[model samples]
Each structure stands twice: as C-alpha cells, then as structure tokens.
Target: MRVKKGPLVVIGDTLLDIDVEGSAERIAPDAPVPVVDVEGEHLRPGGAGLAALLTARDGADVVLVTALADDPQGRTLRSLLNGHLEVVRMPLHGTTVCKTRVRARGQTLVRIDTGDGRALARVTDTVRAAVRRAGAVLVSDYGRGVAGTVLELLGEVRAPIVWDPHPRGSMPVRGCALVTPSELEARRLCPPPYTSPDLAARHLTKALHAQAVAVTLGSHGAAFAHAGGHHSRIPPPTLASGHDVCGAGDRFAGASALALRDGLPVEDAVAVGVGEASRFVEGGGAAAIRLQSHEMGDRPRTPMEVAELVRASGGRLIATGGCFDLLHAGHVSLLRRARALGDALIVCVNSDASAKRLKGPGRPVVGQRDRVEVLRALACVDAVMVFEEDTPAQVIERLRPHVWVKGGDYAGRELAEAESLRRIGAETVVLASVPGRSTTGLIAAVQET
Candidate 1:
C-alpha cells in the first residue's frame, strides 16, 4: 500500500553523512593491504533527519527538530535542505554535525565522526513548539549528544514521545509511546525475568511505564510488549531489501513511531514499520522527499515540450524537479497531482554530484541512479531526466513541458525556469502547498533529537 496523508514529527540528534566509495584492489608492492580506487564521494543528511524523512516519504506531513552550527557546514546544510524541508536550526555552537564513510565495492569499511558530543543548544523553546505541533516525537540517542537536559525539556512537551534509547540513560520519558532498544541496549535497561528478548520486552514495558517497549534484535527482527499486556515479535520487514544497513534501526524507529501515531495496531504498525524498514534496507533509508507527479514514460523536458507533446498527441505536459534522492510520499503526491494537471509528466532529478553540492557534506540520502529508477518504477511518472546543475534552469529550458509545478507556497518568487519558459510561451503555475511536508523538515526532525 502507499502512504496515508497525515502529520508526524521527529526529534533527535541530527547528522550529515559523507559516503566515499571506491573499488578494492591489491596494495602496492611494499605493502600488503588492499587499496581502494575511489570512485565517488557523497554527502547525505542523516540520523534523525533521515528517520523523519523516512516517515514523511511513507506519506505524512512531517516536521523535524534538529541542530546545526553557525558555520559553513551549517550553511551547506541549510541550502541542501532549503526547498526540501523547513528547519528549526538549534545552534550547535560549532561546525554542523558530520560522519564520513570510506567504502570499497559498495561496502562501507570505516566511518569517521566530526562533531562535539553535546546536546543541541537552545532547544527548550523549539522542543515545546514542535511537540505542540506534532503527532509524535522520537528521542534519538546516539550517545554522541542529546543529554538529560534535552530529555527533560522533551518531557514538558505534551506530544507522544518515542524513545530510541542510548545506553547512557536510566529511563527515557515517564510515559513515552514506546521505548525502543537494541538487544545490547535492552540488556542494560531490562531487569530479571527479562532474560530473553521477549522477557526483556515484557519487563522493560512495565518498568518504563511506557505505552509499549520494543527491542530490536538485528537480523532476528524485533520483539515488542505493549502497554495492554499484549506481546509480540516483530522482525525487521526491510532488512533484506536495501543496501547499506547502517541507518536501519533509526528508520525502523521512525516508521514505528509514525505507524503507532497513525493509530495502526501495535503488531500492524510494527509490521508496517518493518516493511518500510525492509524497503530502506534495500536502499539506505527511504526517500527524504517525494516530487511525485506521474510515473509515465520519459520523453519531454520542458512545459513547452510537454504542451507540444500534448498538442501533437492530444495531451498535456506537467513538469517538476527536485533532489528526489529517495522519492518519498511528498514526491508521490506531487507527481500524482502533477499528472492530474496534464496527460504526461516531466520530472528532473538532481544528479548525485549536484545533490552533494547542494545538500552539504552528507545528503541526498540515496544514490542518483537508485532514485531515478525508483521514480521510473512509480505508476504516476511518465518520463524522468537528470540535471547536474544545482538548479533546474537548464533542464527546464531543455525539457520545456506544458506546465511547471513545485510543492509548497512559492507564489511571489520567480521559478528556476519561469522566465525562460515565459520567453518561449509556456504556462507557469505555483502549487499552493502544505507546509512541513518537505524533505528538509524530514531531515531536521531526524537530526534534532
């Protein structure tokens, strides 16, 4: 099934991911180590940001609460997420957060972190505001930051909280929606009679006073004990489906929170979350933002091109573009709507290099090819194209579809290809959109907690 329409929010320690990939080969004559011939370097907004993005891509109007420094990385972060999501930049007092990866043959071998391991600064007000507006919140504990004070601040907010506990804390929130712990983390949080995974979930449920308790057992999937004396085992649904496994847990936690908040049954939500997680496991996380219009055949590039195609074929053209790294719900909705406007839709995807250049040290959560393929597979999309420039002006000029579309409220400003389109006689329409349904908001929410 596709995503449902709704509102959700995520709070956690945010991050940016730097992925470096290369082919592995034998080392030099003197050395005996394997040398990697670097093929590419990529940046992705991750952690809580990715989690929120996953939930949103699954189809929800989502918001994110995260921290960013007052520096270049932070600027990059803002720009990278500018059109994707709205951000509540809780200053970190330093460079924006980052994690660097060194990979070979599509396998990640090493990761280097660069950030001060401290909770986000000036967050109480932000937390209150977000909690007041959100349907749910996930307290992401990475052990790098988000201390007791942050938890305390979160407590004051009335929203349902889902705690993705780090090993450092005692109890998370008093009555959180659920407290999710890995087997290792649960081992530290659970008491006697909670020896096995099931027993551990049961004990933790009662001990924490939360609505439920979930213990993630990696490949073994997950086990849960709800507040109503109900117990079940939930295996990760998307574990075997995606590529990198690094952010699997975070994605699961996010999806689970969203499902629960949406009022789906515990087992059902867990299973759905697991399914969503499986989808991510095959990719990294799910798409951060969805620029959906149509999944038709690839043909024209511009509104004029679309109009001309339509005129020639007795149809109309619809045009849109975005980072579209993951093609989530927002994208799907946008694409579907775009298609509704005409007979065919034209989509321009930001190239990986372009996405990296725009999103910062870590962003575009998924690879360009994967994103393109995903868009191509969607039933709503007709044609897809890739643009290397940060903006889609050149692409807009070339494609020249019948109409140009974008999500959100951008009524006053000139669109990237508007002037050119007008000069060439193409129709321009600004979609009156819902705020907080963007990739940036998804990223910010995932990164904050």
Candidate 2:
C-alpha cells in the first residue's frame, strides 16, 4: 500500500457500452440467426471511461478527461459516469460512439456499432492542469483523437504515465513511464515476423522512447521490457479459460498507472496490472460493472467479497486457517506475517463444533464468535470467515485465494488441502511459528496456576 494524494487522471475517448442479454432458444427462419428473447439491458462506460471506473473501484480518486458530444448517447455515458468519476469534458467532433452487444448464454451473438465520435483538436486549460497535477496518468487511447490532442502535454507532465495504445490511435508521447499494447496491437505496431512478445516490447520501448513497454498476452499475462535492456514475463495466478475479456486491457493499464503512482517499481507495477486483468476477466469483465455497486466507498465487505475485490484489482489474496481458540501473540504473529505475503489476508477459523472436535473437550477457551471478532480487529487481517469443517478445504474452494498459509509445524508434512488448492491453482506456504507461543501452552499454564 502505497497511497498518493494526487488524483489519478485518465485521458482518452469515452464510449457507451450496452449489453443486451437474454436466452436464444430458436433460430430465425429468415436469416439463420438465433432469435434472442430480450431479458434486460445493461449500460456502462466504455473505453477510457471503463479504465477510470476501474481505478475508482480500486479506491482511487479518479478524474476522467475525455471528449463527449452533445448527443443522447453522450448524455447517457456522462450519466453513467457521474458519481463514479470527476469528468473533465473535451470537445467532440461527432456523435458519441456506442457499442451494443447482443448475447445469449454468455456468448455474444452480434455486435452493433454506432457513431463516429472523436475528440476535437483543441485542448482545454482544465485538461492541461489536470494532467500536470496528476499523481498518475493513464492515456487509454481508443484511437479517437484524444491522445493526439494532448501529446504535447503528456510529454511535459512529470507524473508517471501508463499509455494504453490502440492500433488506430496516435502513437504514445515520448517519455511515458510505461506503454501497454495488447499482443495483437503490438504485432500491428511492430509487425509480426518478430518472434516473441518480449522482442516486440523491446523494439516498441526504444521506438516509442518510453521508459518501459509491457506487451499484454491476454490470459498468459504480459511481457515486460525496459529501455535498459532488461526483460521479464509477469504471469497471472491462474490460467483458467472461458472468461470475458472485454475490459481486461483497461483494467491492466489502469492498475499499472495506479501502482506506479504508489511508487512501485515498473516490474512490480506490470505484475499488479497482470494480476488485476486476470481477476477482472474471471469476475465477468466489464459487463458485471453496475453503477449502484460502485457507490459503496469504504463499506465493510465479507471475506469472499474481499477476496473477489482484491483479485479484481490485481492484488494478491492470502488465506490462513486454524482453531484460533485464544487470541495470543502466536496467532497475531502468524497473521501479520501472512498479510505481509500478499495484498489482503483472510483468516478462516474453525466453527465452534469443529473446534471442539479438533481440540477435544474443554478446549477453545474463547468462543468462535469472539475469536472471529479479534481476528477481524487486527489491521493485518482484511476479513474473517468461519468454516464448519475441520479443515478449510471448502472455504478455500470458495475464496480461491492465491496463497494458503499454515504454521511452521506443518512444514514437513503435506497439507490435507493440497489437492483442493491444486484444483484452484493456488500455492501453499508454511510460516515459522513462535518457539514458545501456543494456545495449548497458555491453557496448560493457566491450569497449573
């Protein structure tokens, strides 16, 4: 947790995204197309708007600077973004762009595109000031003229910039902190024939004069290249398939910019972006983003919800399980160390019946509820959940944490949850327990006294 006071500014083009979902049970006799029985309509901000919204969802103060026409579609886009972001409007030369996707059974049937909106050549003083004062800036160019409009300002800004390039868009400004291009877009920019994304990133970094280039490889993660000739691949936690990837690029670019703002190294920032993009697609992508869901600013979330949010933001989620009968230094130490291993820590405590069964009669000096409360009070623990089973296998399945932790006592032996973890593609680690600290030892000492 790096926290920056300056707002994250997103500069790009905004589009209205409409997802029409329903069941397609029959094929039309006239055109041989599936006839979708309309159920409901979902509207959200698209392109740069989506990037800004994602940043805001991750608890950043986001300012979106984009062009919006005076058309009905533009108004809809603004309305959708009103409470989620601070909009700095630029002039648009045409109607607002709208992409309508008709889907059935989670599969897109057809896409209908409307409008040809592009930002005007003129730049505003407000946009200039916003860019200059930004803690971090994400240029989510959708090839809609906004990037070209602010190319000069972007070059002059001292704040770190993460440029999300488009095949049809303007080239990134010189001196960008990081440039993000999808594998397909990288091929379009540097041409194929070039072997791997690593080479593509290296060539683009030098060609664009950027500090670093991250070529996003979709579900495979990203290939990172620095101007100094160092390269590495950032791998996502899981490579599960059949996920919605509509807004994954925006999630990656937006998260990278925020991480850089928090003073993370370029490599770490790209890793954060990769993790966040993976989680975003896994959570149903942009289609799941509802305006009402984002209104909760700092409200408390459940353990599973915390896990989802952490994953969605490209942050790691770690889980530890135990009876936690009595709140002691040992428990605190294990939790704190576990938290330091990832972005958020989820404590899975055994239920009262389960604890009694595991520890025998007269055990669990503290009740399960009290133990849960104590764990939740710790700053190291992000959330706490109780499991009825003796082991946390079921809980782990639901949480799907990236890392599972246990006391050092389990170091030599294989954990019972190992198979469950393998199913979810998670890893397990055992931390060294305090030599003289234990709930059982404390109980024995009290009995002797």
Candidate 3:
C-alpha cells in the first residue's frame, strides 16, 4: 500500500508468453534446422492484462476489461488472474497470445508469435463503461484486438487516457494524458526519430496534442515532454555500474500510473516510476511490491520465502489471518475459497497473549499456538504463522498482498481497513454468504441453557 489515489481501467487484449531456452550447437544432421535442445518452458501473463496486473500491484484499484476464450489456455489465463481484478473473459475468442522466443543469454535472436487476433463485438460496451468509471485509462496496443473497440471508446470515455503505442497497429489515440513509447516503438508509431529522448517527447507531445509524452531509451533512460512545453530525462537506476533490464517498462508504467492518479506532478511521477522500475529490474517483481504477509508451514517465513511465494504466485496472493477461537464451518468455507483465489494463501493467526487481550477475561478457548496448528492442518491453508496484534493489518502492510480476504458477517465497512486498504495496495473481499454459523452467537446459545 504505497498511497494510490484512484482506480485504473485498462482496455486491451490478453497475451500468453512462452520462453524457450537451450544451447545452439551445430547444424541439424538432416536439413538446416539448428540443433537446439529443449531446456524448459516458462509461461507469463502478457499484453494489457499484464499491464493491469502491474498497476494493481502499484496500489491502484485496477480492472482489466478484455476478451479471451474458454479453452485450457483461457483457463490458465483466468487462473493467473485468480480474482485479483475484475475480468471479462470472452468464451468465443481464444485467450492465448503466445510469443515463442529463442534466447541464449542476454539477447533474443528469434521469436514466433501466436494467438487469436479476433476482436469480440460485445466487449467494447463493457470496456466503455469501465473507461468512463476510471481515473485513468491505458490502452496497450500489442497489435492485438484491444484497439478496434478502443478507437470507438476514445470519443466516448471522458477519463484521462494513456497510450502505450506499439508497432504495426491502427491506433487513433490522440489527446491522451500521456503516450509512452519505447524508442524503437516510437519510431514505428511516430513519423520521425529524434536524436534525443527530450526531442522525441516534445515532438510527440506537439504532434499528438497530448499533455505528456515519454520515450523510453532502453540503456540510457526515459525522457518526458510535459504539457508545460518543457522536457526532462529521467535516468534509469544504474545498479552496481552495469545494467540488467527485465520488465522495466512494466515497473515504470505501474509507478507512473499510481503517482499520476494520486495527483503527483509529471516529473515526480516519472521519478517514482524510475525508482520502482529500478527496484523491479534490480530486486525482481516480488520485492518491488513490498508485501509483508507471506507464511510457510506453522512458522513465520523469511523475506526470501515471501519473495519466492510472490514470484511463484506471479504476485497474486490472497492474505488473511485471525484467531478462530471457536472454529466453525463459516471460517472453513472462507479459508477454502480464499485459497482457491490465488497461487497461495498466507494466514496469520493471532498469538495467545494478543487474542486473550482482545477477547478479554476467560476468552480464546483455544490457545493461539494450538489455533495456528489447527489452521496448519487444514488442506486449504498454505501457510500458518503467528501475529501479536489483534488484527492482521501490520502483516498486511508488510506483505502488501494484492487481495485482503476476510470471512464473517462483515461486508463493505465492517470487514476492516475498508477505505485505506486500496491506497495501500490491497483490495478487500468480504465472505459472508456461509449459513448458520457465528462464534458470538454460538457462545450465547450455549450459555443460555
């Protein structure tokens, strides 16, 4: 939770990225194919969905409105989402936007892209509504189906729109809040290629009539052209001298969106983006999010384990910890569903002393250690650890979990940290539908006899 301001809605296409690794040996024996042995396959989220996920981690209330199919790949996509945001998955259109890459070490030599290029007709309406509701909108153009309807959406939605321009796309996005294009991609989108990032940003700004323009210069850094008719270059973080770039743009966009939505000045936002992007490429995505809630077995986990869980879960994690002194079906069902939402579930059970203090005289029929152990034994619980406080707010802040899940009769305000949660980089989901169960009610009923 890094002080986010408003909601971000993205209109774009979903993508599935695949990476191939191996050594390039001699030529093939039969024909001309290179003798490349298969090592392993890596799958990651892509396109606009990826952009949205990144924004969400930056502490924005993000919603991804896109179209994907119901096939296994689509299931994989939805599973990746894991209820992190609101998704509009289209059944008719195939979801996979596959990009096959051949990378030996630092550089990529070849890539084969695949996926359903068909744009759905009905998704536009949903996107339009979402766009109208957002504080800012970023249309990611991957030459995917996001732009067809977005073309129409530009005229209708009044929110500030940011454009992530790409090559070979028929995008008519002008008069946006900001248009961020990589130097290579900028050349493809813009007619001219200026010698410097400043010139490029200014030129694009004057050309597009947009308030701000940014051109990413890979190794050198990023430059911004502001509406005030001035330009500034934000340098990328040079860690230990050399540079190792990986998903830097995603980090930049995430931090930038959060800052802009929060009313930070252009220069300030760009600086923030640069800082976060540095952490991203430097420490990897897990550390960049700054989540404190991550558990393993019955013991509290180290920062490394938490980072691993975040990475393994693609940063999509649902976190909730409490003392269920009574232990009922209500708690069971909520925990079960929360576990299903993401790759892992981290539960923080209150310590005995804290629970006793909160519950008061003769309370917490079960000790905190025993209570945590019980939760650890459950199949749905991924990790069970102890917390000293009455609430899991401290743990939540450290973990900065994407989703804050709770089980009880609470909804909206009654649950916890209702308003402040989003700004701090987490969304709240209330689980109250379970029937005929309540710890206080059960206690009262037993005492009446």
Candidate 4:
C-alpha cells in the first residue's frame, strides 16, 4: 500500500523498552529460579514512540507528541528519537516510564516496570497546532495522560483518526474513524472470558460509535465490523514459528492509519495493516525495529558530510575502495567483515569513467548510479561515495578513515594505496576472500555458457 503525502501526527505516551538477553544456565542456590548470565542489552522506543517510528518507516512524515520527564532515561529516550521524527515533548513531573524484560533464549522470564502513571502537564499550544494541521492522527494510548489531552483536542482536528485503545485509557469519542484493539483488549469491552473477535469488534464499534472497529486476532488475523453493518476478516501472511509479536499491533495501527489517511476504505486499510504486521512478524519482530540511518530524515551525505557525521558520532570509520562493477557474494562478505571492524563503513566506488579506465571498455556491467544504489542497499555498507581518481588516494586523504580494508587478493602484494593510507596514519587490514565467489568468475561463467 502507498503512504499518503502528509505528516501523520501520533499522540500518546512514550515509553522505553529495555531487553536484556542472555543464557540461563544454572539454577540459583537461594531459590529455584534460573540465574541469567546477561550477554547483551538493547534499548528501544515503545508505546507511542513505536507507532510513530513504524509510520515513518512506512514512508510517511510523522510528528510524535508525548510526555517525557527530566531524568536520565528521558534524556536517553530523547536522544534515541531526536533525528527519527518531529517530536514534541511535554515535560511531566514524574520519571519517564520504562519496561525492562529479562529473556533467556528468546523467552521472557521476568519483567520490571518503573514509572508513575499520573497525569502529565497539559498539552502545549504547539501540540494543539500540530494536531490541527496533521494529515492523519494516530492515538496510541497506553493508559498515559497524553491521550486524554489528545481526546480533548479531537474536535479541532478534521483529519481521520485511528485510535489504538487501552482499557485503562479514556474512551474514544464518537465519529473516530477507527478503533483497533487486541483481542484481549477488545474482550474488556464485552463479556469476559470467552468473547469471539467478531463480537468484540461489533461491541467496540457500537460502544465507541466509531466508523469501524478492528479486533486483532494474533495468528488468526483481524476481524473488522463497520458501523454500516459490514463485516470482514483480513488474514495474516504466513509467519515463521517463534516470531517476535511484541510490536505487531503498533505496526498495524501505524500502517492502517497511513492507509486511511490516504483515503483507503476501512476494509482496504485493515488489509494494509495486516500486510504490514505480517511483514514485521515474518522479518523477526522486534529485531526488525532497530534505529536506521534513513529514519533520521537526512539525505545521503557527501564525503565531507560523512566525515563530519562520523566525527560527531565518535565512531570508527572503515573505508574500502573498489570498482564494484557487479555486486556479488564476495563483495557482500568483504563489506560485512569490514563493517564489523568499525562503527560505520564507507565504500568508495570507482566512478563510471574510472571504472572504464580500470576494467577496460564495456567492463562495468552496471552504471555508477545503479552500482551505488545496490551498495547502499546492503546493511553492511553504511555510506557510499564515488571517486574519479585511478586510485582512491584523493578520497582516502579526505576521509582519513580509522581502518582501511582490502580483500585477500592484496595480502602478499604491495598495495598501491599503502603509501596514501600510511600518510593519513590509517591502519590497513587484509580480509580473507570467500572461495569460488567473484564478479569476474561469474562473468566468465556466463560468457562460457
């Protein structure tokens, strides 16, 4: 589905989710519980922040309105979200909300939640103005006070509203475009224990007086009931076992809101939501929601710009130069290993003219634009630049990367760029080449056939 060409305004509570993963080998001596030997930890945006992120990732401009405290976690949350979207933070008196989960081998063993759920400071004039000007509004109420303010301002907004409801939060006003709730959340609206998704959706639609209500049924897909007396079910795409389902609902809400804002009918929008959530789960769930460079709303930088960015982030800069006329597994392996050696990798590609000079006439199977695009699409390559010089000396001097990577083919030979790299005090490392994988070999094989 295509995203609309306007800003999606998300109003709700912002939360920090900390996932501590490791091995739980032996049981504790004092208790029967297993002791987890933590291997790593990841901090992610949760609640409304996640909804905003998903919307932005779906190719929509998003504005996030939420409350944050003046504590360290709040500072970290702001830092993490700063470049991702247009965030309007209303300072609250309490500490920022945080949920920490300890997991062993993908199973969450324990969770610790910290924060006050008291009312936040009232929404500022800035948030009110943003709501009025938004192309669409997504209310992700995790029972926080921000949703209350958004509900108060709904009358001022003419945009379509998609509300992901919480039992603890304020009830949605009549005429809301859609209300999405998980089956568990939907059950709270109707009779307890054994309510079907269809009945729950109908109950929600009638209770909220919304245009439609969608009840998400995890693996079974979603059930939708319209005020106009139409009902539909949108099935999920096939997902692998043990998939991360944590943020699937948020992905659905965000994508569906974008579709509805683009004027898709309720059923069609629900289909888009199902598709987005399915993709998210099938792609490894929460693991797929990490921060990406494109989410910062910045265009690809030039060499000078990249240098400045690397310096500012205080990350190691790894550089490699190649023709990359035809991308192959060998190129991918080298790039991945090079990225592992540093915080970021910059691949210097030979310009079209330089490629022709180095590889002879009609050598480069692909043009420079397509070559750069292909390289940039690889997760291992953070940035790409084109150089016209025969050697990458000019680019090397400009970047002065911390590490200069070369493939195994150059291990025993005197590298032409060694002197240039030495002048900049950059260390050079040679990585092993993958056996039987090369662009040249592929070209020769095709020619033989």
Q: Residues 245-353, candidate 3, lDDT per residue (tens digit)?
A: 5356765765576567667776777777776565445432321221112323243345336536665645456677677888876677567556544546678777888
Candidate order (lDDT): 2, 4, 1, 3
Selected candidate, larger lDDT, 1 vs 2: 2
**Number of the top-ranking candidate, with TM-score as the measure:** 4
- Give me the displacement of residue 100 in model 3, in angstroms: 2.4
lDDT tens string, model 1, 1-449? 33543357666667777767677877867777668787555555677776665554445667776776667666666655554455655556456568888888657777798876355446567666766776667777665454354666766656567888887643587888788888888888866445698888888888888888878876667888988999988765323344566777887888777777777766676676565555445433322122322222465544455556556654456778888865556678567546545557778888989999988877788898888888877655767788899788887777667677776556567776667788657766544342246777777767886
TM-scores of all models? 0.63, 0.68, 0.62, 0.68
Candidate 4 per-residue lDDT, tens place, 1-449, comes to: 33434689998888998878789999999999999998667677899998887666543678999888888988888887875589988867677889998988778898899998444658679988888888889999898788886666887778889999888988887788999999888878776665589977877788789999999987778999999989878897654543578888998999899888878888898988887677566544664344434322353456566666766765567899999877876787677556645456789999999988998987788999999999988765778989998999988998889888888688679877889899999977675565456788889878888
Q: Is candidate 3 or candidate 4 better by TM-score?
A: 4
Q: What is the TM-score of candidate 2?
A: 0.68
lDDT of each: 0.67, 0.84, 0.64, 0.80
Taking all chains together, the TM-score of candidate 4 against the true structure is 0.68
| Ten-residue region with minimum lDDT total, candidate 4 | 288-297
Worst 10 residues of 1 by lDDT: 286-295
Query: Which candidate has the highest lDDT of all?
Result: 2
Q: List the residue pairs that clash in candidate 4.
A: none
Better-scoring candidate (TM-score), 1 or 4: 4
